[model samples]
Target: MSEKMKKIIKIAIIASLVSSAYSVRAQEDELSNDSHVTTSFVKRQVAQNMSIGRAVKSIVSNYPQEASAVVSTALDMYPDKYQEIIHAAISAQPMLTEDIVKIALEKNIASCANIVKTAINAEPSYVDFVVTAAANSTPEELNEIVRVAVITEPDSADFIVQSLAQQHPNKIVDILSSAIEAVPLVGEYVVETLLAIFPNDAESVVSTAVRESASERANVKRIIETAQNFGLDEESIYKYAKEGGATDEEITAALSEATEQR
Candidate 1:
């Protein structure tokens, strides 16, 4: 071939190679975009089929805020599944238990009492978060929640009661009384913690403990002694104990013990 023809042929071959490379690059880019779209669509469909708990767990690591939004939406659509979803979500991401419970309480997605109870029951370790969340939105429900917590998770009762009593002192009597009434066995623990934490409220705490305890005689005697140790007057101790259902005889015996100790 002539030198000029050979040069033209070489140029044509180079152009063909460049065109092929560009076509391959364009095809790759298209495939990449298609893959992204397909992935997003698949996720959407999966979310719809699965429980909010499962869906949130799947996305919470990478998209916490998005997971939260998805959960909120799912709650709205399937209120019946609130408890189930809450358990699943919290189990999947224990770290988000507080956030999920707070949202549930603030939004009033389920019965405030039920939600708090369920959260505590589902994850007793998260009792503080559940109690705090309920206290924030529905303080009135705290009493019932405490009652349930004491019975359901007696081990956590001390912490729950102490936290609530410290945070809402005004509710101390109600909280202590409800807990003792629901789970009479917790009375001793409640009395011990309250006296230690709120010594100044000894009279009121002792009084409530006596009145609400199912084992009135034993609890009253214990309260009477604890009260006297706290420097409460025998007259006041007797009054509170008697009011709490200690018979006149029970009060006399308790006072006798106090006198002997003194």
Candidate 2:
């Protein structure tokens, strides 16, 4: 597995454990009084700022360790404001290992990396901060952040693949394709992590991941054939075939099986 994939996955697993630890205690009826501030007050302060992005940065920068709390405040101040700033930051830094890419990409929600890339280049160290915070974010938040960040830095393939392989191998199976070109090492990881995640989509994701340039030629061919013989189909078959570079016969085999099932 690539180092990038490892780091990303590591963050995901860590975030999951941490969130689960607190979720049970945060009952819906239990109103947040201390660390959890209200949203309206945040909006009023954001309005006084020059720009929403700047306003967000001001909070995170000044707070340092409180980046998460500050962002929460910013969102309460302006719902989704934090996401917008993240989008801007990721957009600006395509090459940086945006630890938050998965924050946006989880659960199949499409993200606009172009918008996030704009702010990434403004500061390289911000990459580290985003990565750390992104790791701390909840699964849902991580998914959203990733959906946006992946598109923002679609070129950081190594980071994406390794992170998932080691941390959240389950999720990496599907969405690692966006940056395969930039991080060739991750292609193999994509296949490996897909197999590890072992969800309904694993077969398809693994089949496709094998076709990436980083994939071993023999391994790619083997997975494509396995997918066809196993009878996967539709989006699953499409995904596998898309990556496998399967010939007409191979694709037809998978499609035929899917068609029969339907």
Candidate 3:
């Protein structure tokens, strides 16, 4: 069997054992439901200063369906301990990062940016996954997720932006804008990254950057120049720039600069 399959089977077996133990406790104590039992169990464990990892693992494994509630409860109880809570939860249910992130966001959508950054910080390898989950949980928070994810894990900016762009095809412009806003130094790289992955959205990508950053002549010229280098034709570039809300003056100046660079 594959290593991943074997690992999954092993985890399943362990979860089954932990669940049986908890089942015995539930029956003995007349616990109402898995959700209540898990939440109460986590709160008790935290109160007693127990191993959060073990507590989280046991509850998440035994009550996968209640993982979100359990995680949310843990985070809500320990508002300042989000990193610790997210880390323990992810370590226990590495594959349930989505649920953990979603629950955290649901509990506190205002902190979408911080939640994403913390989740990614817990498991840097899951930057894309974290960003996707945060976006999925709160589509309205896509821009904030993109901004924070890019800022937190700049190394994964390309993947983060591409993932959101692909998932939110209509929000390509906003995704690009948020990403560039997070790391202005990577304005050109952000443009090229999305354009390369979403070549079909060339107009949207180029024009979005131009229109969004219209006031920043350097940013506008830089994106147009990068789009041109990415092989986007000049006429299409100008046309899309206008469509993207770039003024005739801005487009003229940007195109002139792009041409001058060539």
Question: lDDT (CA) for every model shown?
Answer: 0.72, 0.48, 0.77
Model 3 Cα lDDT, one tens digit per residue, 1-262: 8999999999999999999999778643533364454456666766665766556666666666666767777776666777677877777677888778877777773478888887888777788889888888889888888888888888878888878888888888889988877776567777888888889988777777766675566777677778788888778987887776766776677667777777
Model 1, span 1-262: residue lDDT tens: 9999999999999999999999767634533452321334325634775654565555454344444554565566567778876776677667677778877776677777788777876788978777877786777687787877777778877887887888888889998988888877677677778888888887788778888874656776766676676676878877777767777887788778977987
Estimate candidate 1's RMSD in Å.
10.0
TM-score of each: 0.70, 0.39, 0.66
Model 2: per-residue Cα lDDT over 1-262, one tens digit each: 9999999999999999889867535422122345553455345446777666665555444334444444444444444454575553344333332433433433223333432343344443354344334544444444444444444454543444445434555555434554343344445444444454455666557645655543455444445444444444456755656565755565556456544655
- Better structure of 1 and 2 per lDDT: 1
lDDT of 2 at 8: 100
Best by lDDT: 3
Question: Model 3 — TM-score against the truth?
Answer: 0.66
Which of 1 and 2 is the better model by TM-score? Answer: 1
lDDT, candidate 2, equals 0.48
Kindly give the stretch of ten consecutive residues in candidate 2 with the minimal lDDT sum.
Answer: 106-115
Winning model by TM-score: 1
